[model samples]
Target chain A: PDEGAMAQARELQGRLTKPAGSLGRLEELSIRLAGLARTCPPPPVDPAAVAVFAGDHGVHAQGVTPWPREVTAQMVHNFVTGGAVVNAFARQVGASVTVVDVGVAVELPPSPHLLDRKVREGTRDMTVETAMTRDEAIRAIEVGIEVADRLLDAGAHTLITGDMGIANTTPSAALIAAFTGADPGVVTGLGTGIDSETHHRKVEVIRAALALHRPSPQDPIGVLACVGGLEHAAITGFILRAAARRHPVILDGVIACSAALVAAAIAPESVTAMVAGHLSVEPGAAAALAHLDLSPLLDLGLRLGEGTGAVLALPIVASAVRALHEVATFDTAGVTDA
Target chain B: PDEGAMAQARELQGRLTKPAGSLGRLEELSIRLAGLARTCPPPPVDPAAVAVFAGDHGVHAQGVTPWPREVTAQMVHNFVTGGAVVNAFARQVGASVTVVDVGVAVELPPSPHLLDRKVREGTRDMTVETAMTRDEAIRAIEVGIEVADRLLDAGAHTLITGDMGIANTTPSAALIAAFTGADPGVVTGLGTGIDSETHHRKVEVIRAALALHRPSPQDPIGVLACVGGLEHAAITGFILRAAARRHPVILDGVIACSAALVAAAIAPESVTAMVAGHLSVEPGAAAALAHLDLSPLLDLGLRLGEGTGAVLALPIVASAVRALHEVATFDTAGVTDA
Candidate 1:
C-alpha cells in the first residue's frame, strides 16, 4: 500500500459533497484503491479479467460430489465458448474471461483464450494419499504467477479468481480446516446440494485425509502439496503475484478464499491484494473470509463459483472508483456541509 | 406478483447450468422480476428512473439537526445541476434523475429536471401539533403517484426511491416507531452525524411524538398524516403506485424504508414491488427491513440518502434479469446438472 497516495485519498474524501464518512464503504474502497493504484483518483476496475482455472480433483473418485470429473473439461469448453454464467457476467461487466488448463485428466484442444499450463494429469486421491508432490505444487504456483504476469502485461487492471473442478470445495474445506484450525464439521458444507448422507461422508473423507497427511500450517506450500487442489495452488500463486505487483484481486467463492488462506500464510502482505467479492452459501466461505478479516462487497448468498460473484462485483468496484473521480467536492460544488 | 410468470421463472432458473439454489438470492430476485413483469424473462432494469423527493421538516427549527432548512432548497438546486452524489451515482448507473420538490420551505425557480409540487412550506412540528393535515398528506401522496406515473409512462422499468430533506430521518424514525412498534432509541439514529446531545434529544423527540399521537399502524394514512415528511408521504404513495402499475422499485435508506413500512401496512401486496437496496448504517433501517421481510441486496454501512444506495444496486438488479434472459440452460450447453 502507498502511504502517501492513501493519505491523499483520505484528504480528498473529506472534501466530497456529502457529509464525512456518509458514503461508508464506498469511501473506504476508494481509499484502498488509492493505496493499490498509488493515485488519489484510482483507475477504473476495468478492463478487468477473470481467470477460470480448470483442473480435475482426484477426490472425485470418492462420491463426495455427484458432479463427474468430465464436467471440468466440459466447463472449460463452456468458458471458452462463452456458454457459462461467468461468461454472461463477464460480458455484462465488460471483463474478459481467460480459461487456464492448470491440471486436467483429459486432453484439451488449444484455443485463443485457453492457456495450456497443465502441471499434472491430476492429483492422487487425497482420501487415501497425498494430493500432489511438492515440486508439482511449486510448478502450479509458478503457472499462476505467470498467468498474473501475462494478464497485467496485457493491461488488465484487476484479476478475478475463478475455478472449475468437480468437488473442488471438498479440498477447499479441507484446506480451510488445515489453515484456519476450524473443525471439519464447522467449516464443511455440502458443495452442490449433496444429500445428508453424502455430506456426512464428505466430512469424514476430509478428516481421514487430514489425519493421513497431517499438513502443517507453518509449511503452507507443503500443506498445499498434501491436500490442496491444483487450481487452489494456482489461485494462491495468483493472489501472491497480484499483491507482489500491488494489483487488486477479487476472490470469488470458497475455493478462491481457501486458496487465499494459504497465500496469506506464505506472504501475509498478499492478503492486501484481495477483495472479498461476495458471500457464498457454503459454510467454509464465510469462515475463510472471517479469518482473512475482509468484508465482502456483496452478499446475495451466491455459491456458484466460476467467478460469477467476482464479475458481478466489477461494477461496484468501478462505481467506488468513479465516485472518487466524478463526485464534486463541497468546495467546488458550493454545497454546505453539516 | 404474477403467479404464472413466477412459476415459469422458477422453471427457467432450474434449467440454468448451476445447481439448484446455488445462485441463492439471485434466483429469488429473478423470480420476483418475472412476477413483476408478468413474463419469464423480464425486461432489463435499464431505463430506470430515480425520484429525488426534496422536502423540509418543521422539526428542523427544533435543532434536530445542525443543517439549516434552507439546505433542502439548495440541495434541490444541487440535484438539478448534477452536483449531488445522487446525480453522480445516477450517471454511473445509466439512470435519469428527477428532482421533486414535494415540500421545500424555500422558494425555487424551475428547471428542466426539477418538479415543483410543494404541498405546503413544511409540515408542523409533530412535537407541537400534527406534522401534516389529512388533506395535505393525501396531496403529497398524489404527487408521488403522479411522479411514478410520469416516469413509468416515459418508459422506465424501475423506480428508485430517494429522499433529500434536512433532518428528514426525524420523521422517518417517528414513522418507524409508530409502524414497527420499536422503541424510540432502538429506531432513532443520528441524522448526518449529530452530536451526542442532539442524538439523545432526537430520541426524546420521537418518544414524545409517539406518546402524543399514539398512531395506529392499521390506519397507515392517518399515521402518515400524524407525523411524516412530505417526501416520506410521497415515497409511500410512490411504492403503492409502483405496485399497482407492476413496476419494480428500489428503496434507499431509512426514509424510503420507513415509507415502505407505511406502504406495506396500507396494502400488504405492495411489498412485492419493493427491493431493499442496502442496509443503512442507521438502526431504524434494519428494523424496518425486518418488519417488511425484505433482505437488503448490499450492506456497506451506507446511510447517505438521495438514491445513492439504490443507484449502486441497479447493476445487481439488472444482472438477475440478464441471468434469466441470457444464461445458457444445461440442455442447450450440454452440461450436466449437479
Candidate 2:
C-alpha cells in the first residue's frame, strides 16, 4: 500500500459534500482501499468469493461440544446446496461461495464447488499429541495460498475466510492465549450452547493442552502444528496471501481470528489485508481482534462461522469503496461546505 | 403488528440452529418484522425507497451555520441528478430515491423524480415567531403521509427517512430539548463544522426558542409548529403513516430522530415501526434514540443526513429478515446443539 495514494484519497474525501470526518471509519476504510489499489479511488471490489475451509478437530473427543463430528461434513453439504445462512447471505449480496475440504475426516466424493485440499484427515488430539506434524501444517498453509491465488486468477477481487470444524473454538482459545498471553478462562467461551459442565471441561482441556505444548508465540507454524486446527493454519495462510496480493480478506468468527493472530505473527504486515467482518460472541474473537487492532464491520451476535459474517458485510464493504467512484464532489454539485 | 404472529416468530426462532438468544438484537428485529408482515418469516423488504425531504429554514438568517441557504436547493438538484452521496448509496443497494420539495425556498423546475409538495416557502424565524402556523404544520404532515402512501403504493416495501434543510439541526436540537428535557447546550452540536463561538450561539438560539415557546411534551405537533423545520414535520408524518401501514421505517441522523420523537409522541406505538440506522455524532441523535428506547444498527460517526445512514443499513436489515426466511432449522439440517 502506498502512502501517496492514501493521501490523495483523503484529499478527495475532503472535497465531498459532507463535513470533514463526518463519514468516520468509512472514510478511513476507503482511504485504505485506495492505498492498497494504488489509486486515488480504488477499482470496484466485486465478484467476491468466500472460501469455507472445512476440517475436523480431534479435540471433539474431549467432550467439548455435543454436536457430532459428522455434522461438519453435513453442514458443508448444506453450504453446497445453498441451504445455509451463509448461502442465503451470499445470494443476497451476489457473491459466490466455495467449500474447501482442507482436512475433513471423511473422504467425501468430489463436487464441482468443493475444493479437495485435505492435508490430513484430522489433527491429533492436542492433549494426547501434537495436532499435526509441522510438515502437515505447512502443507495446509500452502494449500491456502494456492486457494487465494486461484480465486484471484479466476476473477475474485475480494476474499473472505470461513471455517467448519466442530469444537474448533477450544484450540482457537488456546492459540489466542498463547499468542496474546491471556489466560485460558479469559479467552474461552461457550462454543455452541454447551452446558455449564461441558464449558468448564472445554476450558480445562485448552489449559491442559497449552501447558503440555508450551507453543512459542514467536514460532507461528510451530504453534499451529502443536495446538491449531488445519482450517486455522489454512486461514492464516489465506490472510497472508491476500496481504501479499494487496487484496482484502474479511475474517469471520473465532477460528479465523485465531488464524489471523498466527498469520500476523509470521508476517506482521498481513494484518493490513484483514478486515474484521464481525465481532463474534466467542470471547476469544474480541481478544484476538483487539490485539490485531481491527474493528469488525458487523456485530449481529452471529455465531455461525461459514463466512456468514463476511458474506453479510459484502455490500457494506463494497459500498464504502463504491462511494469513492460514484458520489459527486462538492464542486460537481455546486454546493459549498461550512 | 399481531401478537399471534410475533409469538409464532419467536417459536420459529427457537427451532433454528442457533441457541435461544445467540443472535441477540438481530433476532428481536426479525421477530418484529415477522409480526408486522403477519408471518413467521416476513416477505423480502426489497424495492426500498428513500424520501429525501428537501426544504430551507428561515432561521439561516440567524447564522446557525456558515453554509449558504441556497445550498439546500443546490443539493436538491444534486439529488435529482443522482449525483449526491445518497443517490450513490441508493444505487449501490438497489434502492430508489425521491426528493420532496416540501418547503424549498426556491421553486425547482419540475423534474420527474422530485416531489413538488411545497406547503410554504420555508418557515418564519423560530426565535422571533412561530416557525409555522398550526394549519401549515398539519398540511406539511399530510403531505408526508401522502408521500409515504404513494411510495408504498408504487411498490416500495421499506421506507427510509432523509432530510435536507440548511440549519435544520438547530430546530432539531430545540425540539429534542423540549421533548427529552435535555439542556440546549448538551443536545446542540456543531451542525456542520461551526467554530466554538458559533456553536455557543447556536445553543443560545435553541435555548431562546424553547424559552419563548415552552412547548408541551404531550402536544407533539405544537412542538413542530414551534421549533421544527418543514422537513422534520413531513418526516414525522411519513413515519406515522408507515407504522399505521405496518411497514418498517429506517430513521437517519438528528433531524430524522427529532421527527421520530414527534411521531412517537403523537402515536406511541409508532416506535415499533422505527429502526435507527446509525448514531450520528450530533449529540441530539443519541439523546433522541435513547429517549425513544431504540438502538441504531450502525455507528460509523455518520452525520450525512440525505438518507445515507439508512441506505448503508439496507443490506443488514434485509439479511436479518432473510435469515428468518432461508436459514435451515436444526431438525432439517440434522445439526445438534452443543
Candidate 3:
C-alpha cells in the first residue's frame, strides 16, 4: 500500500504544470510525501526541527585539525546563543535548531535549546583504544531516538540532522572505510586544513587505529565504538527514529553522513527519508554518498564541518516539496503533451 | 560612486563567516548588493517581483521547439492561474509573478496578474527582416523600466528576470553569435529537446539569420532590434531601471542572460545588481555567463525557461544576504580562530 502511495505521488509530480522530471530531488520529495500521507494532495507540513549533535574525539591528540577540542563546546555555545550560520539559516527558513552535547568534554549551562545527552566526556583515544564501548554506542543511538521523538511530538514535520564535533572526521573516515571496503588512505583527508606533513601523520594514525581494532562490518555498532564519534551514533539513531515515524530527514556533512550509513545498516528503510544536501569536499563524504547511492544537490567544494551546507540547502528542499504540492497538472492547465 | 559602493560590499562579504573566498557566486551577490544599494550592508532586500516575459516568434514556423506557438498563451494562462512551477516556487518564496505579453500572436484577456505590454502581436521573421523596429524596441525598454519602477514602489527590493517566449532560443542564439563573436554552430543548440536532425536544422537557421544581419556589438540596442524578442528588449530595460533604483536583479536563463548582455552594454554598472541563477544548459547561456564574467550557483542541467531556476535559487540568495546580516564574526563569538 505504501508503494502504491509512493507511485501515485510520483505520477502526480510528473503531471505537475512544468517540464516532466525537471525539479529533480524535489520530485522525489513530493513522491515521498504522497506515500507518507497516502493522499494525492498531502496536507501542509512545516515546523521543521534541526538537531545539531556535538561531540569530541580523542583522535584530536594526534594533531589533525589546527583548532583544539575546546572549540567544539565554544561553537556549541555559539549555536545555543543563536550566533552560528545554521542558526541564521534556520531563522530565515522558520526551522528551530537544538544543540545536543553528545560527547563534549566541557560542561554546558542549562538552556532550553541545549539537549545534554552526552555518552561520555569524550571518546577514548582511537589510536590507542576503541573510541567507546558497544554499549555506549547503543546509548548514543537511544539519545538520537529520544531527540527525534521529542521534536516529532513538538510538531516538527521534517527533521534536519546536523552535527558539530572536532576531529570527528577521523572517525567518519574510519567508519566509511569499513563500510565501503575503501582504503583509509583513499577515504581520509585532512579534517580541518592540516599541513601536508600533518595530513600524512593523520593517515598513519587511522591505519594504526584500524590495525588495533580490526572491527567487522557485520557489527556496525562495534565499528562505531572502535572509531565513530558519539554524534555519529546519535545521528544514526535519529535517522532510524525519523524513518520509523516516516518524516523526511536532511543529512548535513561527512560526520552526519557516516552516522547515516550505520543507521541504514540497522534499518534499510531509514535511507528512504534521507536527503543528501550537498557533496561535502571531505573524501569520506563522497565515499559515504557513493555507498548509499545518494546524490547531493549543491557542490561548491565546501569543507566547513558545521550544518552550514545543510542550512543553505533547506530552502531548496522547501521548494521541492512546494513544487510537488502546488504546481498544477497538465490536465488542469489544458496544456499540450510533453 | 556605484563602483565605490560595489567595492565596499565586496569588502564586507570578504569579512563574513566561513572562508574568505568561499560561497562562490553568493560572494558575488553580496558585492552586487553593495554596489546596488551604494551601502556596505545592502538593504533588507526581499518582496521580489519576477516579470515573466511572454512572446511568440514568427520563427516558430521554422520548427524550433516541439510545442506550437499556441502553447505560449496557454502557459501564460497557467502563469496567471498560478499553475506553473515558477508560480509555485514564487509563492513558496513570497514573490509576486507578472506575465508580460511582449509579443504573442493571440490577444490575452484582461487579468490583474497579466501585463498587456505587447509591442506587437509577434515579431517579424528575423530571417527575412528585423524582428522589431527601433521605435518598438525603445517602447519595450520603456515598458521594462515602468515595470521595475512600479515593482520598486510596491516594496519589491529585488527584481528577478524571467521569460516565457516560444521559439525565442533562435533569436537568443543569433544574439549570442553576433555579440560573442562565436560561430552560430558553437552558440546554438537544440532547444526544448529537438531531435538531432531538428537540432542541425535549428543551427542552420541561426547561421542563416547571422548571415542576413551583421549585428554590431557597439550598438547593442540596434543588435537587439535586428534579432531580439520584445521580451529581450524589455528585460534589458528592466535591468537598467532596477540598477538605477538600486534593486537587486536575478537573471533567469539564457534569454534573460542575452538581455543582460545588452543591459550591461548600456550600463556596465547594471551588472552590479545582476545574480546569475544558474548556468543554463543552453550553449548560449554558458557563453553569455562567461562573457559577463558571472558564475551561477545552481547547475542541475536545467533548460526550463520560465524563471523556475531563478525563483528556486532565491532562497539561497536570501541566505547569503541573511548570512551577511546575521552571522556573528569570530570576534563576536569570542571563539578561537582556525
Candidate number with the higher DockQ (1 or 2):
2
What is each candidate's DockQ, to 2 decimals? Answer: 0.64, 0.65, 0.54
Give one digit per residue, the lDDT tens place, for model 1 in B38-63.
98898887789999998999888778
DockQ (model 2, Cα): 0.65
Better of 2 and 3 by DockQ: 2
* Ranking 1 against 3 by lDDT, winner: 1
* Candidate 1 CAPRI assessment class: medium
Q: What does the interface RMSD come to for each candidate? A: 1.4, 1.9, 2.4
Tens digit of lDDT per residue, candidate 1, span A173-290? 9999999999999999988789999999999999999999999999999999999999999999999998898888999999999999999999997877889998888899999999
Model 2, range A167-232, lDDT digits (tens) per residue?
Answer: 788889989999999999999998867888999999899999999999999899999999999999
Off by over 4 Å in 2: none
Clashes within 3 Å, all models in order: 0, 0, 0
Q: After superposing candidate 1, which stretches have Cα over 4 Å from the reference?
A: none
Which ranges in model 3 have alpha carbons more than 4 Å from their true place? Answer: A1-3, A32-45, B1-28
Each candidate's lDDT (Cα)?
Answer: 0.90, 0.88, 0.82
lDDT at residue B113 of model 2 (Cα atoms): 78
